[model samples]
Target: MRVYDVEGFPNPARVRIALAEKGAVDDVQFVSVDVMNGEHRSAEYVSKNPDASVPLLELDDGTYLSQCTAITEYIDGTYSGASLCGQSPKERAIIHMMNRRAENGLLDAVGDYFHHATPGLGPTLETNQVADWGKLRKSKAIETMRYLDDTLKSRTYVAGDTFSMADITVFAGLAFADFAKIEIPAELTHLSAWRKKVAARPSINA
Candidate 1:
């Protein structure tokens, strides 16, 4: 499989972490895509992923998987190691719920704020920016972080006790937030604590 992404980007980092956890990092080929240069928007790349997004996975059989969640699910189901997706139906549903919340509320919000409100990746990559919408999303991202903090206060991980894709999404979200200069309020001690634990994991080093 070939995974196309940019290094140091949060979404790609999520896939890298999942691949590391699955012990499949060495099995797949990594191809760097330069978003700053509009490489992702090129026709050649768009043919593989029409969305023009990074962290895309192309299977050996010539099938391309674009979304991070879909790629992560494929890795989790196909490889053997610690499962990032939950094992049971209930666990799966809860994890998926939390994962979507993390993506919409935090990660995607931060990205919107960066691209629209701030000059994210500069003017070359960011077009048609809406300052008002981006500012709104920035505020919403913080609000969601507070909600997540509350959720973390009662559990060892997001979506109950085990580490799952939901946790991965939030971890990547927080990392993206840092890039956007959005800080988790100091009062969110539980979220901070949880972040510390996740950061120390060996897969993070990958």
Candidate 2:
């Protein structure tokens, strides 16, 4: 399998981290996508992913997969070394729920704010359409962070005691926010500590 990746990007980093957690980093081929030069918008890339996003996975059988969440789940399900998703139905549901909360509540909001509020990049992003909504979205993201910080005060990871897919999603989302100049609030002590833990992992730098 081959992974089309981009450095300094959140989505690709998520997959890379998952691969690292599963100890499958060296198993797959890596191809860099030059987002700086608008390579993802080219005809060749468009053919692979009509949405023109990075972090696309190409299977040996010629099947292509997009979206970081879906790609990471595929990797975790296929690899047996470490179970990043979960082992039981209840665990799976909890992890999925937390992952969705992080993605929809924080990650998507951060992306919207970055694309609409920040200058440069996001040329095709609907700046006008999201201009008014950017502030609201950013606020929502902060609220989610506060909730996560509070909930995580007594837990080690997002989904409970184990580091699961929910942790991966939250880590990636927060990492993305870092590049956008968004800083975690000082009150979110639990989340701040969790961020350091995830960052210290070897896979995160991969």
| Top-TM-score structure, candidate number | 1
lDDT of 1 at 112: 93
Per-residue lDDT tens digits of candidate 1, residues 176-206?
Answer: 9998999999999999999999999988897
Estimated TM-score for each candidate: 0.98, 0.93
Candidate 1 pairs with clashing backbones: none
Winner by lDDT: 1
lDDT of 2 by residue, 1-206 (tens): 99998866878888888998888989999999987778898999999998799899999999999988789889998888768888899998998899999998888888887777776375653436566577777887889899899989989999999998789889988987887778889989999999898789887777
* Poorly placed runs, candidate 1 (over 4 Å): none
What lDDT score belongs to each candidate, Candidate 1 first? 0.93, 0.85
